[model samples]
Target: MPATRTLATREAADLIELTRSLAVNELSPKAAEAEADETFPREVFRMLGRAGLLGLPYPEEYGGGGQPYEVYLQVLEEVAAVWSSVAVGISVHALSCFGLAAYGTAEQKEKWLPGMLGGELLGAYCLSEPHAGSDPAAMRTRAVRDGDHYVLNGAKAWTTHGGYADFYTVMARTSDDRSHGISCFLVQADTPGLAADPPERKMGLTGSATATMHLDDVRVPVGHRLGEEGQGLRVALAGLDSGRLGIAAVATGLAQGAFDLALRYAQEREAFGKPIIEHQGLAFVLADMGAAIESARATTLSAARLKDQGLPFTREASIAKLVATDNAMRVTTDAVQVLGGYGYTRDFPVERYMREAKVMQIFEGTNQIQRMVISRALSRPAKGTITVLSEN
Candidate 1:
């Protein structure tokens, strides 16, 4: 809870404090019970919306906070430290809005942007399908052109905020051209033919609903289309670049939470007539955990800074997500180990932390996919590579 790093602006500092207050007072207390019950805390999201936390990274003219990605991500980390489900929900909502914000027509923005950013309407991203989780380009969800609408048919898998979202930002195939066939649509949650399947029984993030959304003859107006017919893939990929950073921050926060718990327990729990932290064996573990958490935080923030500067951050984003999430998995697991048998029990939250941390490496693209992204980026030539003439 102590200051981990200094803020660039007073406003950023204020936002962090506000988020911390909410996380400590509201989120942390209810996380255990809600996760235990597998209940989605819908009202808590509304409270966050009302507090102007939901739209931190969007333009201020559209009722958002208009903060830099760097500031917004840190706020996300603060919330994530207490309740990861809520933080992940926040990240998905931001991603759901990205297409419209970045690609929608001015008229569309005028009509829907304010309400979306104002927090009255929670949003979900629907790009992944059952047959195509990693290779979204191979998706088969179809959207046929109707008189004045596009009738969507197919299912989206692993949809967060599935049944509860007020709106869904969906991507569906519109043509046979594999590279340029998809399009984005903003569909209202109450659309007659759209329904969420039963939630997936998950190992972690139980409080966050994940379900397959069925689009059975769902009709969205042509006006709801976000960009050109073939631009959906581009929009989705660009959004993921930022979304990866969000997950990175959340992963870092999760690691920090686990580390804090382990440290506190070490200080209080004694072994061999002294605090276990006094023993070099256990002390080294705690030290390594601390080091990992800080490293993850720095990697994530560095990516955010690049994003804030409008630099190309695709590689950095993947790197951040990979490092932070992998570190989170390790740190949370170590926290459980540090607690010895007590950590494995439900009586302690380290078990839950370990469970939650596992999914961070899997979602927002798997760590395997992240490595692919990083390596592919590496394969590309640099923008400026100086060459010196050499005689062999």
Candidate 2:
């Protein structure tokens, strides 16, 4: 038997089935339109929220699916296979919810958890700044302690759902102790002095809003602090680890979706004497794409399994994120090749998939960061090395 089945639980299977129906019936149809218009599908997100797809992997007590991370990520992969923007947005929202789930007080959970999990309120994570993309220690966003609140000041860059989210989990400097000086806050979007700096024109994932968030002396109550005063870096890093897993899932889905399109097109599109599927050259490319997609899926699922088992998944997650995203870029580009001239034009959906794949490699701490994480995970020792004095 498999160490752990990918789709074991009936609840998980049902949730996957539901998401598939939604993806095929709703997401796939509007994907092209959304990408072309560069419009955020706020309503589509609400539809997913209503379907309870947004809450997969969360506890049922909070109006969530209560599914395992493995299953949830697979479902995420399915969503991404059709439209990556939606899949990534869902993952980012889940990352925003992490602070409360892992570190918030019970009262805080009772108050904020339901809306976030229910998808009634979207979420945005604010850790990267103009100066700090992968380096949190260089963050300039400051949160000064006041009587009962912290005054937040600075801009958060490349924030997904920037203006659209109901909440933002912000990380800002509290002291001059580098990374340790950072603090995390659950700042509502309705808070005064918080403004989104217009959506950016990006290479892909245009359906998901991306912008800079300006915090002008915004006051976040002391009660809204995620963990301890100076524990923000820990929280931010944890969120990033989990976010990398999410990206891995999305990347796998994109690859699979692109492969499926290429396969069908190859089988149907006739050339020369017969269908292109009969051609050895094109067949080899399709086979490689298939292998890459399946491998990415397996790797991503393994990382999720490690996370679910409460094991150290840092290395596994980084590996998954790195491999899956790179595969997505390759698979999508090859898919465009499969379509020949049609792929190059907006007339075909392969062009959109190709554009979306580029961001997957760049976001969620970048593939370079993933390599660093994997290296550290591999290089670290369980305990400090000690030298025994040899007989001299």
| lDDT against the true structure, each candidate | 0.93, 0.89
Q: Kindly give the stretch of ten consecutive residues in candidate 2 with the minimal lDDT sum.
A: 1-10
Error of 2 at 157 (Å): 0.1
TM per prediction:
0.97, 0.95
Per-residue CA lDDT of model 2 for 226-306, tens digit only, reads: 989899999988888889999999998888888888888999999997999899999999989988888888898878877
Q: Model 2 off-target regions past 4 Å?
A: 1-6, 382-392
Q: Evaluated with lDDT, which candidate comes out highest?
A: 1
Return the clash pairs for model 2, or none: none
The number of clashing residue pairs in each candidate reads: 0, 0
Instruction: Report residue 39 deviation for candidate 1 (angstroms).
Output: 0.3
Local error of candidate 1 at 249, Å? 0.5
RMSD for all candidates, in order, please: 4.2, 5.7
